[model samples]
Target chain A: MQKIVPNISVDCVIFGFDFKQLNVLLVERKLQDEKTGETLIDDWTLTGYHIFEDEDFDTAAARILKGLSGLDNIYLEQFYAFGKVSRVDSPKDNIWLKHQHEGFSSRIVTVGYYSLIDNSTVTLQLQERNVKWFSITDLPELGFDHQEILNKALEKLRSKLRSEPIGFELLPEKFTLSQLQKLYEAILGTTYDRRNFRKKVLQMKYIIPLNEKQKAVKHKPAQLFIFSRDVYERTKRERFDFSI
Target chain B: MQKIVPNISVDCVIFGFDFKQLNVLLVERKLQDEKTGETLIDDWTLTGYHIFEDEDFDTAAARILKGLSGLDNIYLEQFYAFGKVSRVDSPKDNIWLKHQHEGFSSRIVTVGYYSLIDNSTVTLQLQERNVKWFSITDLPELGFDHQEILNKALEKLRSKLRSEPIGFELLPEKFTLSQLQKLYEAILGTTYDRRNFRKKVLQMKYIIPLNEKQKAVKHKPAQLFIFSRDVYERTKRERFDFSI
Candidate 1:
C-alpha cells in the first residue's frame, strides 16, 4: 500500500475543449454512512487523491491524471493551494471524508492543478463509468471545495490563454479559424467580432495556415491552420496578446 | 494553546528594495544536538512556521508576516509549494527538524509565499536579532531547501514585475526616476539604457511625475515621481509591459 498523507491532497481540473464549449472531467462520488449503510450523498467532483509520502505534488497530480484518464504528457499547471479550514464543511462531505480515510484530519490542504487535454488526439482509456465530462456552463453540485477549485482553475486558464500559447494544447492538429475563435469564446466567456478576431490572430506568425481544407462537411470547406511550436518558441515575447 | 499542523509549513520570501539593490529578509537558524548539546548547523533561512489548524493559508501567511516584520497590509503573494521528500535530507537539518517539533513527520510540505516591504516607510519591530536583510547578490548559504525556495520566489517576482506594478510596493511613496530604473535593474539582474528606460516608463500614464525634487543630496537633485494606483487601474489593460 502507498503511504499517503491523509491531511494533504492534490486535485486536478482537467479541461477539454470541444469545438463548441469547454468541458471539465469530473468523477462521480457516492458516499454511504458506515454505521447505518445508508446512502448519504452522491455528487460529482474533480478527480483527486491523497498524495503519497515520497512523491512531489507535481508527480502526484500527473499520476492521478494518468490513472483516471489514461492520458500522459498533458499540459499540467499548478495554479493554487486551497487550504480553507471549512473546505469540507458540508456535513455530507465531512462525513464522507472521515469514512474514506482511516485517520482523517480535520484540516486538509488541497493543491489545485489545471490540465489541458486534446481529447481528439488521444483516446482516453477510461475504465470507469462514473468519470465523465460536463460542460462548464452546466455543472452538477460538486463535492467538497471542488467547485471552487474548478472555478479558480478556469480563471487561471483564461489568464494563461491570454499570455501563453496554452490554448493550442486543447486544440487538434488541423482546425478551422471558426473553431479557433469558438475555443477562445468558450474559455473566455465572451464573443469576439469575427473579422477583428481573425485579423488579430492572422498577425501572429506562430499560427501557420495550411493549404488543406475540410473534406467531409455539408457547409463550405474552410482552410485549416496548425500552431507552430517552433515559431512560437522563437518569437513569444513580441506582444502575443489574445485578450480580445 | 494553538494547534499547528506539524507536517505543513508556510515559508515567506520577504523582499525589500533599497535604491541600490534588491534585498531579501532571512532569519538565522541555530541548531544543536539533543544528546551531546553540541552545535550542529547555524545558517540563514526564510522566516516561516507551521500553519495553525483553524486558519486559512492566506491568513496564516499574513499573521506570520505581521508577527515577524511588525508591518501590516504588505503585498504578499503565494508563489509555489515546495514539497520534496528529501527537503530535509541534510543530516543536520533532519536532526534540527526532529528537535523543533514534538511529532515531526518524515515528509513535510511547505507552501512558499513572497512579500514586498518598503523598509523606509515603516520601522520594522524586529524583536529578535536572528532576522536581517541580505542583498540578493551577496548572501550566505541558506538552511534546508530555503535557497531553492528563494530562487523560485525571485523567479516569480521577476515575471510578476514585468506584468504588474508590484515593484512599487518595495519603494518609498516619493522616488526619483533613477531610483525606479535601478529598482528594475536590481530585480532583473540586468542594466538598461537610461534613456530608453525613462522613455518606456514615461509612456505609461500611471507613473506620474510630481513637481518635486530631492532636498538634501550629495549629487544633483532629480525630479520625483509616484505610482498612481488610480491611473494604473484605469489604463492597466492598455499594455503595461515593464519588460525593459
Candidate 2:
C-alpha cells in the first residue's frame, strides 16, 4: 500500500460539456445496511481518494479522474477545500460508514477539484464499474457532502466560463458559431440575442473563422470557427474586476 | 474539548493594503532545536488553526482572522488548499514540531485565505502576542510551508486586484490618483504612464471623484476619489476574456 495520509482525501468534480448540455461524472457506490444486513447499491458520489505520502494533490486528483473516467490528459484545477470538521464522520455518517467499511475513526478533510472535459470523447464504461455521467439537470441523490461539492463546481465553472476561453475545452474545437452560442446558453441559462451574440463573437479577434462549413447538415451549411490561443496570449488584459 | 478533526487547519494570508505599501500579517512562532535543546524565537508564521468539528471552513478562517488580527467584518476569500502528504510531519518539519508540541500525527491540509483590509483602521494589538505586520517586500524567514502559502496568496491577490475594485480595501476612503496608481504599481510591480493611468481612471464611471483634496502633505495637494461599489454593481460588464 502506498503511504496514503489518513483522514485526508481529494475529491474531483469532472464537468463534461457538449454543445447541447453540461454534465458531471459521478460514481455509484455500493453499501450495506447495518441493521438489515442487506447490500444497498447505486449511491452516487464524486470520484475521490486519499493521496499517498509521495504524491502531489494535483497528481492524485488526476489519477482519480483517469481511473473513474478511463481517460487521460484533462487538466484538473482545484477549486476549494471542504474542511468542515464533521465532513467525513458524524454519528449519522458513522452508521452509514458501518455499511461501507469495517469501521470509522477520525473525520476526513476533502480538497475539491474541477475540470472541463469533452463529454463526446469519454467512454461509456468506467474502470471501477458503476461510474456514469449524469446530466446537470437530472442529478441523483449523492453521498457525503458531494452535492455541496457539485454545486461549488458548477459555481466555479459558470464563473470561469464567463471570463475565460475554457469554452473550447468542452467543444469539438472546429465548431460552428451556433454551437458556440448553444454551449454558452446551456451553461449560463440565459439566451443571447442572435445578432448581438454574433457581433460580439466576430469582434473577439481570438475566435478565428475558418474556410470550412458544416457538411452533414440538411439546412444551409454554417461557417466554422476555432479559438486562437496565440492571440489570447498576446492580448489578455487586466479588466480590474474579479467578482467570480 | 470540542470535536475537531485531526490534521486539517486553516491559514489566513491577511493582506493589509496601506496606500503606500503592501503588508501581510504574520505571527511570530518560537521553537527549540531538538538536537541542541536551545530555544529559537522569532520565526514568523501566518495565523491559523485546526478547525473545530462544529465550524465550517469559512467560519474557521474568519475566526482565525478575528483572533490574530482582532479585526472582524472583513470578508475573507479562500484562494487555495495546500495538501502534500507529508505537509505536517516530514523529517525536516519534525525537527521544528518538536518544539511546537510533544508530537505531530497524520498530515495537516491547510486551506489558504486572503483578504484586503484597510491597514489604517486596523488596531495593531492582537490576542496572540507577537503578531506583526511586515511589508510584503521585506518578509522574514517564515515557518512551515507558510512562504509557499504566502506566495500563492500573493498570486491570487494580484489576480483579484486586477479584475475587481478591491483597491479601496488597501487605500484610505478619500485618496489621490497618485496614491491609487502607486497601490496598483506596488501590487502589480509595474510602472504606469501617469497620463494614461489618469485617463483610464477618469473613464471609469464608478470611481467617484470627491471635492476633497489631500491634506497635511508637503507637496501640492492632488484631487481625491473613492470607488463606488453601487455604480460598479450596476455597470460591471461580463468582460468575456478571462485570461490573467
Candidate 3:
C-alpha cells in the first residue's frame, strides 16, 4: 500500500461521451455506520485516491484512473482545487467517512481534474469495484464535496468545448458534421439551427473533409471530416467569439 | 498566529496592470545556507501563507494577502495546484527554505491563484513586508516552483481575456479604444491590426461608446468607451472566436 500523505488528495471526474448523452464515472462504496451499526447508503464518490508522499498529484490521479478503468495515456487537465474548510471530516460527515476507509485523520484538500474520453476506447471489464456510469443529468449525492467538484469539472468541460477543438475528444476519429453537431447539443443541452451550425463550421479552416462516407446508414450518407491539428496550429485564427 | 496546516500551502500570483506592462507582486526573503554558514540568494516568492488547520485555503489566501498588502474582499481565483513531490526540502533548495519559514517538516503542495487588478485601487501602505511589484518580463528567478505557477496563471489570463471581457479589470472605468488595444497587447505580448481591432471591438455590444473624449491631447481627441457588464451578461453568445 502507498503511504498516503497527510491532508492531501486527488479526485478525478472522468467524462465519457456516449452516442447520445455525456457520462461520468463514480465509485460506489458500501459502509456500515459507526454509531448505529447500521448499513449506510452505498455512498458514491469520484474515483479518487489519496496522494502518496513521493508521487505527483497527477501521477496519483493517473494511477487511480488506470487502476479503475484499465486505461492509460488519458489527457487529464486540472480544473480547480476544492479546499473549503468544511469539505470533509465534519462532525456530521466524519462518521460516513470513518466507515468508508481506515486511518481517517484531518481535513483533506483535493485537487480536481477532468478528462474527456472516447468511450469506445475504454475497456468494459470494470465489474469488481462496483464502478458505474451515470448520465450527467442524474446523479446521487457523492461523498465529501465531490458533487461540487463534478459540477466544476462539467462547467470547465462545457466552457472548453466552446473555445477549444476539444469536442473532438468526445467524438470518434472520423465523424460526420451531424454527429459533431449532435455532440455539442447533447453537452450544451441546447438545439441549434442546422443551417447556422453548418455555415459556421464550414468556415473553420482546420476541419478537413475526407473522401470517406458512411456505409451502413439508412439515411443519405453524410460526408466525414477529420480535425487537422496541423492546420489548426498553422492557420489558427483568434478565437475571440467561440461561444458565438 | 494561525495554526498552520503542515504539507499544504497557498501562493497567490497578484497581477496588476499599470497601463504599460503587467506586474506581479513578489515578497523577498533573506535566507541562510544551513551547511555553508553563509547567506544564500535573497530569493523572491509570491504573496503566500500556509493554510491554517481550520481555515479555508482561499480564506487563508485572502488573509495572507490582506495581512501582506492590507487589501480586503479582493477577488482571487484558483488556477492550478503545483504538487510535485520534490518541489522543496531538497538539498539544493532547503538552505533557502530553512531561513524563510518555521515548523517546516515535509514537502508542500501550493495551490496557485491569479487576480487582475487596476493598480490605482490597491493600497500603497505595504511597509513591513519586503513586497514589491516586478514587471513580468524582468522577474528574477522565483523560489519553489513559483515561476511555473506564474506562467500558468499568465496563460490562463491570456485565454480568459479572449473568452471574456476581463481586460477591463486592468483598465480604468473609462478608457479609449487605443488604451484598450494597448492593454490587450501588453498582456498578450502581441499586436493587432488597428482597423481590425477597432471593427471587432465595435461589434461588441458591451463596449458602449461615450460622448466623452480625451482632454488636452496633442492629437485630435478620441472618443472614450466603457465596458457594460449589464450588456455582456445579457448579450453573451457562443464564444467560438473570442480571440479575434
DockQ of each: 0.30, 0.49, 0.52
Candidate 1 per-residue lDDT, tens place, B76-136, comes to 9998888787886798788677677667567778999999988776556577547888999
lDDT of 2: 0.79
Off by more than 4 A, model 3: A32-39, A89-92, A125-127, A202-205, A241-244, B32-39, B89-92, B125-129, B194-196, B202-205, B208-225, B241-244
Quality class of the docking in candidate 1, CAPRI style: acceptable
Docking quality of model 3: it rates as medium
| Residue pairs with backbone atoms closer than 3 Å in model 1 (clashes) | none
Q: Clash pairs of candidate 2? A: A163-B242, A240-B162, A240-B163, A240-B164, A241-B163, A241-B164, A242-B163, A242-B164
Q: What is the lDDT of candidate 3?
A: 0.80
**Superior candidate under TM-score, 1 versus 3:** 3
Kindly give the number of clashing pairs for every candidate: 0, 8, 20
- B1-244 per-residue lDDT for model 2 (tens digits): 6766556688999888777788998888766666997776547888888777677889988888887657788868899999776665545466656655733355667889987788887886655467788999999988788899999999887877777778777777888898888889889887899998888888888888998888888989999898888888988765455543
Which wins on TM-score, candidate 1 or candidate 2?
A: 1
The per-residue C-alpha lDDT of model 3 at residue B12 equals: 85
Q: Which parts of model 1 are misplaced by more than 4 Å?
A: A30-42, A98-101, A121-129, A191-205, A209-211, A238-244, B30-39, B99-102, B122-129, B190-211, B238-244
Better of 2 and 3 by TM-score: 3
Top model number, TM-score: 3
lDDT of 1 by residue, A47-157 (tens): 888898889899999998998878888889998898888898888887787676678677789999999988676456566547888999999999888888998899777
Q: Return the lDDT, model 3, position A226.
A: 95
What fraction of the true interface does each of the listed models get right, in terms of native contacts kept? 0.24, 0.75, 0.60
